[model samples]
Target: MNRKGYYSIQMQAVCDNTRKIRDLYVGYPGAVHDSRVFRNLPLCNSLEDKCGRYYLLGDSGYPLKTKLLTPFKDSRQLNYNIKLAKSRYVIEHYFGILKQKFRQLFHIKLRNITFIIHFIRAACVLHNAAIDDEFQLNENIDMVNEVLPPEQDLDFVDEEEDRDARRVRDDIVNDLRM
Candidate 1:
């Protein structure tokens, strides 16, 4: 969906601590921003615990929500923000493994977005299955890193600024101080 002749689809994924993808959403046009894709997804309703005790850690591209924690914009390297950012590595690692195992995702040349989405979904499922089979990817880690582009700073939009979400973030910051 790029204006310059490139067409592809985006994937939004959630990985557990086990490095296995727990939830995957695909089919958003490549031109669409990641935050929009995440907003439209029903992950909040489906993943929120009854006790409201669980939360998912997301990177800068995701909006802060009660159920999803994001680091402060232009963070000052506070301990709380440092910890959250450090913990977010798991999901990034999952993506790296998926793209490494399914080279198609590395440069999705398929014109049909639907097909690209299906391919990505299948890759995610296979990635998880491989984990279950005790697959070791340590050897491929360096090779994958070599081909991948350096991480870019994403421009995030605060689509829905909820006071409650801010409160939750503040509470976390305060707790870290204690």
Candidate 2:
């Protein structure tokens, strides 16, 4: 946490299967990237007692490991890499909500590294607490409950349209595979 002088530090958070953030890691200022920073999280003896053990999902900026998740490849893996890849975006969206709601963290007036990271962590804890405290449905904002419906269904479309859309997606996915 002593490292400082760069605004390019990576931030990390462990999310639940429901996509609610269970833990947060603001990270030390420097070259520590997602993969290493992610694995460095203090692990507990039992996953039941430890949060985020469902898995660590991160962006391509993060490294891939049995303990951490990233995009899938045809390359052999011990687990289902493809599924984790599809789900990692939730963490990115969580970050978006965080920055949007707590803008101060992004623009901490304090120059000290510990203060910057600590302030962010404090904000995240508050945010998580708010989420934990409030379970009411926000109908005015069209906000859904914490638990989401399984495998959201896309807009209703004809079979032909769906097939064509999927073809385009498959093409893009295939291109990325190359």
Candidate 3:
């Protein structure tokens, strides 16, 4: 059981600006923090081993890393942060679609974690299939456009320790300012 007093499963997905899921990770319990799920995945290592300038925009719940950009928390940097937040909305939209389309995700009550994982993964697959088939979300559900921030403890990073990551973030911030 999670902190929510019930069994819960979480999914970490990578979505494109087109609001279509590109990749996903599943099977973590609801109590597991998003950053923890990310750290446990091979995805971070794979990206670190790559040579490109690719990066994923994550919300504040995620730790800032060279491969993952997160919004600036300072109120003074609100404008700059909006750029990252706006780009990150695609994943939120994808989640909104997934929850609305597969209502099971909204209120899952399965006792088996394995079943819950498969169920959520299947829903994601079907979601992608529909997108590939040119399906659009119903207007009624489309009205739910806002991203709901998850209730998880934010992971803190030492700016001095993650110097490289900070530099990369600053560079992106500068570029976005142009």
TM-score for each predicted model, relative to the true structure: 0.78, 0.56, 0.81
- Each candidate: what lDDT? 0.70, 0.53, 0.74
State the number of backbone clashes in model 2: 0
Tell me how many clashing residue pairs each candidate has: 1, 0, 0
Task: List the candidate 1 regions with Cα displacement exceeding 4 Å.
Answer: 1-4, 50-52, 74-77, 139-161
In what order do the candidates fall by TM-score, top score first? 3, 1, 2
Please write out the lDDT profile of model 1 over residues 1-178, one tens digit for every residue.
Answer: 4567676567788788788987778887766877777778878555565225878887666677877877776545356666886677777777777776888777777767677777778787888888899987764222112112223235543545556777888888888888
How well does model 1 score by local distance difference test?
0.70
Residue pairs clashing, model 2: none
lDDT digits (tens) for residues 1-178 of candidate 2: 4456436556667766444677666755556544455446664222235533444554445433334434433444313345445565566556666776788756678877777778788877766776788744332222222222223223332476435534544444465566
Choose the strongest candidate by lDDT. Answer: 3
Residue 149, model 2, lDDT: 20
Candidates 1 and 3 compared: the better one by TM-score is: 3
Question: Highest TM-score, which number?
Answer: 3
State which candidate, 1 or 2, has the greater lDDT. Answer: 1
Worst 10 residues of 1 by lDDT: 141-150
Q: How close is candidate 2 to the true structure, as a TM-score?
A: 0.56
